[model samples]
Target: MSYDTEHVRNPGGAPERITGIPTFTELLANVDLASLYTDIYLSTATTGPELAETADVSKKTAYEYLRKLERAGLVSETGDSDGTRSYEATAFEMTFTVSDVEVSITPELVVVIAHADEFPVIERVLEERGLVTFALAYDLVVAHSEGNVTVRQLATLTDLSSGTAYDIVEAIYEIADLGDDDAGPTTYSPNDVADEPTDLLEELTDE
Candidate 1:
């Protein structure tokens, strides 16, 4: 079956300006070689062979680019299957001041490490729900506040499949050390804790 190449590249224009985090534009400016790193992260995975093909490069070229990303501490190689390697992006952190409130952000870039120039729906998922939820999670932790937005709500609002929404929710729960309160069904509460994700990524890659 033939698939459209641009299918994932169209994440509906640039992501909306995040309230207290850098936009992709700001990231590209402040983080050296941002575009190259983003390109490599998005394209190096097994699913997006066409990215390398379209770039007129060999798999070796893609690997080399990914290697650079590794050295820069931006991505880490996961594992190999049938001689093809997998990779996961490192978490990206930034600080911004909005409305006189200084905020810090550490978000999963979730840029479809395998699919490169596609991930249209996934990117949409990130824009509408994931990034904002990251910020909200952090904010809630800082303010010592509580609220509930169920996985079903997220699934419906973001148009993500239930499984995808569960994946995202589980990741967030794991990262934040969050757990459910009054659980007949699961509802999550952010913990008063902070973690550096380096060790976590290493553990994940090792597995």
Candidate 2:
């Protein structure tokens, strides 16, 4: 979908046709909480029952969470009836600091993004490999995108064990589209990673 909501940036005024529910498309007041809900809704439109089933909450709790998401401007009600309502996630980039913590939310780093349609190939890869796996690989590739980064650095960035990070090189080699024979299940130093991540990028997109 085409960024259903306008991205809010540092201390902006409210948006046009802003919701009356206090948070109206400005930088999020509660960045972490907003990220949690936005992540849940970004890739799909869901109704109360559907959300309840997936989130394993009571129907009333689902509706309560839905209300909060609506207020946060991350979700807008698309349909409603005497007994039902559907809410769709809206795309919005966010950068905010709460206390000493800073966050940047975008389509690339997060498994769920409201602009999933814009990156259909990425979406397809996510569909194929699933979000948890793809996000790890994505983090790995992005870390190395700048230049070679150590397995320890990747482990820290991707929240994998050092050994797990080391093991992933085999999978990366199998999936890499490049002709680098050195990538194929060969011994690599804990401090070594490819200088380029173009192979992963190419696998993720036609562009």
Candidate 3:
């Protein structure tokens, strides 16, 4: 007797949604919090139970991922529904403060920017200066971009040690030609200083 094999219309009971949400599309290329954020965001729904079920993750995992989105101010709680909380996807506006001014950013805007497409071209700067110095460099650059920031404030922003902070300020001075030769305190903008050559310090040493 010959046996007939049956072909099922759907295998494994339908395709399963992918796990892990990404915070940013670029992050998909790497394993990072951004990617994790994106994954959970795509999987979850406004309904708590539905979200938990869709992500195929425990409630705790769902909550944690949701919290990350909340902290970034990308997600907001819509309101309570049937005694259960509900959330809806909101457009992510890339907004941040520089100096005392607020700036709103958009994905399309980032795409057109010369250096905005990728994150952290300053990794090498950090490697050379250590985490503290790298952070100082980053904050100071941001301040410069925003058009105003004090050294002390930048220090706090970057969490740099006093000595490290001073060094960063000096480095900016040299880069922008606002050295002691200038009458006023050296002030620079992030946009102006952010594009320093990767080998700037090295090149300076060879001179």
Per-residue lDDT for 40-152 in model 3, tens only?
A: 34544465565556554567876766676565555567778679876654555544455654445443222222121233333333445443345345445445434455555
CA lDDT of every candidate? 0.44, 0.50, 0.46
Tens-place lDDT per residue, model 2, 1-207, is 122345544444444574533543222233333334554556466676667666545667656766776776767878776678877776665555545444455533433333343344444444554445545555455444434445555555545565655555434433333225554433346455545353543443443
**Model 2: residues with Cα > 4 Å off, grouped in runs:** 1-42, 81-83, 97-103, 107-161, 164-187, 190-207
Q: What is the Cα-based lDDT of residue 114 in candidate 1?
A: 22
Model 2 worst lDDT run, 10 consecutive residues? 24-33
Which regions of candidate 1 are displaced past 4 Å?
A: 1-62, 70-92, 98-103, 107-122, 129-133, 138-171, 174-207
Q: Give lDDT: candidate 2, residue 50.
A: 67
Ranking under TM-score, best-scoring first? 2, 1, 3
Q: Quick one: best TM-score, which candidate?
A: 2
